[model samples]
Target: MSSQCPDADNANATPATEQWTSISKHVVNSYLEANNALLAAMGFSSTAEDAPTTESAVDTTTPSPTAEIAFGDENWVMERSTDDYDTLGVGDYVRFSKPIADTDVSAFARVSGDTNRLHLESDFAEDTQFGGQIAHGTLVAGTISAALARLPGVTVYLSQDLEFTGPVRIGETVTAECEIVEELGGDRYRLHTTVIGGDDETVIDGEAVVIINELPGK
Candidate 1:
């Protein structure tokens, strides 16, 4: 019976490992160069590392940090819209559209203290009726708040009713729109509140009563 020398085995393995490491680095560099060229050809002005974040890419006219967060994506027209309920007619409405990033759900969980396994864990969610992780019904409902912020006046939510009709996957852009369905008289109004899923389907629909207080000194 015989046994190989440990030092001899290590010596043989070193060159193979080093050779593969060198090859891997070359392949990576080639990929990076190719990617940069394609990005340049497609009008990508900055490399991914140098690209501006959604938060920084926006113009400086935003009114608040929250508004800046809501307007994270400029591709959506609603991101640039102003809050003005005075000009709203019965059929008119405003929408706030933004994609639900992975960070959003995690942040919601941390802030809300709603660490529902269905909303955070994939393995557990796969067994649920939802079949996979779906955004919290309440978190998705936050879109309603984003929309109402766009309305004129000091908007206050007196009450709201939500009927969750579908699940929204993270990263899917959802648009929350509020329409003046009926004027409740005085400074109050009845609104048709809804959230349109990224798939262009209605995932949430309900009604809300709000007080649109007039601006101060005006």
Candidate 2:
């Protein structure tokens, strides 16, 4: 009788396991690519890399620092009343503006689960009082949050009171302005927040209370 070697058997199985893993990854990647294409056609932005992989591990390392303050892209417009974080007080303000696109509405709908027909289906919306599709009220109101982020320091929202005065149509540009109105004790301040659409129409009016903290290592 011939004796079987365990090392040879283990080596033989390793190649087959690796080959199967490679094939499975290829199939999964192909399916994700196709799904991403379909999502893009429906005005939703996605990529194959966005799909979670079973073998991928979460990154726990410290992030690297950047040269400038992090903000939005070139398409976004931002203006701030001050650059010094320590000098933030009453009268300090930040204005952030961007056009509400179809893709933005689609992405927001997916993220927020606010798939109301008035903000999605044009045919259904045209039959309503809006005459056409409009962006979600909360989505337009979110601009206030974006503006607050551009303030000189790290801003943490304590509370917000909002009144939806007008509707924002898709593709319309809107500007969110937040001005510090009152300096509450303990690095906290109350801000007058408003989002203005075209023709100087106020789409959203609100007030927010926030605490601004100094950036780490600053």
Candidate 3:
């Protein structure tokens, strides 16, 4: 009877353990799929075979077409005063605009380690003074960096000062306009940087000093 009992227990435990393992794999795969999708949206490719289907995924096997500027996607809008890197001077400006999607907030939260409830949880944010989820201030401010990247050269940030005057709601399209206001010489320039939200509100006001180096092989 003791031997029979051991056999019965082992038989039952085998199926149960197998079931648990399958469930664990499913959970891990789901998480990986979501993570891979987020990575793809942020201009990264996942080599995982079972990564989730995302329209943003780039084919790693193919060579990307060269562009005049290595920035932004089709959904992004860019307006620049000039493309001549050598001629970039005072009055040269670039405006880069894109919607702050939910995925962006999620990705930012994960990457930046800023899992603030106000930016991640809609239900929790609804009770806040802003009354809804808003994108991270630094995330919106990053648009200014994006705008600077579209400038006529390899732009390098020297320093930046930012003021968050307003909140940017999730899904709002914001435009970062960076205009060279002064030439500081030795490849350095001071720029007025401003981010305008969807409602035409200035969400972020800032100034940045940067050095624009010629693109490699230019």
Candidate 4:
């Protein structure tokens, strides 16, 4: 259940315990304040409050330590390609996957109050050429990142060249995969990507420039 008291304000200097009924519900900064005040009230008798902490506890770590993508080594960019040499070429693979669904889409519709038939009404899809409801194109593009995450050394994507070649029907599982097609100078690798449906037909096709960093800082 939500707290009965008014939401905390920036200007208010009230003690968090007095304003917020439960300690667990307090915001991070307010929780810290309440904790410190509670400790101060205890006269610092608790060893837990006085113990020294290690730097590693608060330090952030990379998502994948082993994943490495080779960016341009110095020579590739120096020699400006005048013809087909710019292509990323065959045998280069870019991987990607389906996006997980959640109740957020329902909440999003409720909050924004956008009751667009395509987004809210599955029945409306029956009348359309697509035959059934489909997610927004932008939403599908976000899933492309998840797919590329599976491949090694691909840290960041430069752009999404997404084309809705065919409708992505509801309940269908689609996967995005790519192949290296061209190379743009300065650590940018151009990948030709496609979103394939359960039937193995292309649903979306596009190109992306990915930055492959060599030797990411550990």
Candidate 5:
């Protein structure tokens, strides 16, 4: 539903016109509330406070480096390859494994000062929202990058966009995989990476735009 607020262009209308505009807005708001209830019954997750559509007028936000990684393609697959590892292309994947343990979590929290109970204490976390301990998202992201470094030719990671979908519990081994999605320029490749648990559940998914000095194993 569209906002029924008075148009800013017509702000100089007469007082009675303004009053009618206010009433129109009130009627529109009530109509929206009723429509939202109907939508909620159909499993819509958004509330009325969230505008159905909006365009930010101020364009001061920095663009995500990973945003263009998937821009022009529709058939892109991010899975690891059994295809020759030696002939890695702009969209090939490599995998590495790591264990999610308390030692790693604790060390991460200590170094980062992110003592959130869900990552620090098993008991506190159990009583809280998550119901159990979970690995730190940053740690998972960092570990993926760390694994990538082992392949060689990595000069710098220009940026990363990480999203944690599910929890990574202690002792669950996760394999970090990076799929070369596209080449941005010379020695700069956009990689779609993921960290999945032993059971094949995704723990952390991210895209990293990495700048490598040379091809790996070169």
Candidate 6:
């Protein structure tokens, strides 16, 4: 879209539209330059796409050498990615599944100060439509982070946008799936994150922006 300059209020006033225009232009130009360079260094011919793309053509990811996240401890036994950050591209992802145990929900409520009766008091919830204690939405959303953390390199979360589709009850299992949807230049990547469970339904859906960086030495 072509942006028009807003009428200036004072000699020093800059137009809001113009500011946004310049910011957008700079971001695009910088991304194109950086992404192209990265691909060239990696010996790839394809460049970043306008929309999120799949990683089907590129099978760079592999299985984990060992399941560091053993079962029976946290009950987090599910998909784990063995892909390196340098090799990761669009559509790459890591998934982790963990049961929303009653204790987990209660702990989250206590620590996060979100002790809503709906999630803590079973009797209260039983009387309500839920019919039992439900887990906090944010607590379920945290699973997305847990999955993303399993990705290679040091994962630093830049932003996460989420939408809760359904509620999770104690003892129910939830799986967080995060896939790269866009290469946002440099070490930054945008992922399509979703948490689903209970009769194979989507409980929470969202997008996450993360920066995967190399360790101090390796």
Q: Each model's C-alpha lDDT?
A: 0.69, 0.78, 0.79, 0.51, 0.63, 0.72
The residue-by-residue lDDT of candidate 5 on 1-218, one tens digit each, is: 01133233433333545444544554566556656655544435345455345567333445444423322113222234534434556756677776766666755654565656466545555765668778877777766776566444544878888888877787777788887889787777888888888789997888888876754445
Clashing pairs counted in every model = 3, 0, 0, 8, 1, 0
4 or 6, greater by lDDT: 6
Error of 4 at 28 (Å): 20
Tens digit per residue, CA lDDT, model 2, 147-218: 999898899999999999988999999999999999999999999999999768998998999999998789
**Which sections of candidate 5 miss by over 4 Å?**
1-87, 215-218
Candidate 4 lDDT over 1-218, as tens digits, reads: 11133324524333445423322333444445556655545434234644548765542433332223232123111111122323334456654444323232333333444334454345554565666556555555555666555444534876777788765554556677766677675767777777777678887788887875543442
Candidates, ranked, TM-score? 3, 2, 6, 1, 5, 4
Which candidate tops TM-score?
A: 3
Q: Give stretches of model 4 more than 4 Å off.
A: 1-90, 99-115
1-218: candidate 3 lDDT, tens digit per residue: 00122123332233435533554564566568777666655555677575547867544554344442243457899999999998899999999999998767766665666656677656656767999889999999999999998898899999999989999998899999999999999999999999999999898998999999998886
**What is candidate 4's CA lDDT for residue 206?**
84
TM-scores of all candidate predictions against the true structure: 0.63, 0.70, 0.71, 0.51, 0.57, 0.65
List, residue by residue over 1-218, the lDDT tens digit for candidate 6: 01222234434333446544543554566556666655544445543553236666664645333333232344666575565656878878899898887656645654565646566545555766778778888888998989887788789999999988887888998889999889998889999999997778998999999998875467
lDDT of 5 at 101: 63
Question: What TM-score number comes out for model 3?
Answer: 0.71
Cα-based RMSD of candidate 1: 15.2
Q: Who is ahead in lDDT, 2 or 4?
A: 2
Candidate 3 residue spans exceeding 4 A from truth = 1-71
- The prediction achieving the highest lDDT against the true structure is 3
Ranking by lDDT: 3, 2, 6, 1, 5, 4
